[model samples]
Target: MELSNINWMLGAACLLAGIGLGVLGYHLMNAGARNAQMLRQRLAERDRQLAELRDGVGEHFERLGSLAAALNKEVGEATSRLAVEAPHRPDLAAATATMPEPEEAATTSDDVAAPRDYADGNRGTLSEDFGLKQADGDAPQPPRY
Candidate 1:
């Protein structure tokens, strides 16, 4: 009787262990699937957000184009008005007629200073040996502790 009971208990424990292992293995096998589904969801969400951003940018550019068109129309009207009025106004026409001569507009070499590249003579940042440390051969070396 005792032998039979021991055999039955052993069989039950083995069955329970097998069920536990099977459950664990099933979870392990499908782990990648769960992660893949989550990634797909995130990708879809990002795509939706990107579509919304593109739409907003398109609308903003449309608004800007309309404003630029309006501004250009106003500027053209103003220029046309000025052209019609300039012929009647002798003072405005006279000012436009008097253009400065090329010789008068020319600047002498002495008037304009040449561009400088360095801050100082040899110690400037642009010099090749500016940042290098000088070797001290005469100084005694201290012993390291």
Candidate 2:
């Protein structure tokens, strides 16, 4: 090729390449902006949902507190009424009365007998009785499948 024609071709190729790179860069930047906008919208929606949930929980706690207070008031009134009426009823008198002490014979049963010790029941091999050791000549063989 001629030297001037070669130079012209190189310059045209560089120009084409520069234009392609610029277009690609612009599209990529616009795509990033679109993605950022979408993420911001999702974040705003999540924030709104969280605020609603917080309000709902606050209302629930208020209701629970009121219910507990009412229950306490009702229980106090019932307890006072029971205390006033208990002495007038005959059936409740036995249950409400103080207990009597037992005779001396009942408390001496543990002292009369000594506690007996037993061997542990879970330590031996499966083939032998749990509390007994296996004989040296009589080891159990594994079963065939």
Give the C-alpha miss distance for residue 59 in model 2, angstroms: 0.8
- Model 1 spans with C-alpha error above 4 angstroms: 87-145
Model 1 poorest 10 in a row by lDDT: 101-110
Candidate 1's residue-wise lDDT over 1-145, tens digit each? Answer: 6999999999999999999999999999889989999999999999999999999999999999999999999999999998988765358767867965466347565478778766555689767767566677755569999
With candidate 2 superimposed using the best TM-score fit, by how many Å does residue 90's alpha carbon deviate from the native? 4.2
Point to the candidate with the largest lDDT. Answer: 1
Local distance difference test values of all predictions, in order: 0.86, 0.85
Kindly list the per-residue Cα lDDT of model 2 for residues 1-145, writing each as its tens digit. 8999999999999999999999999999999999999999999999999999999999999999999999999999999998888775467667657656567867887579665454445443453475556688977879999
- The TM-score, computed over Cα atoms with residue i paired to residue i, of candidate 1 is 0.54
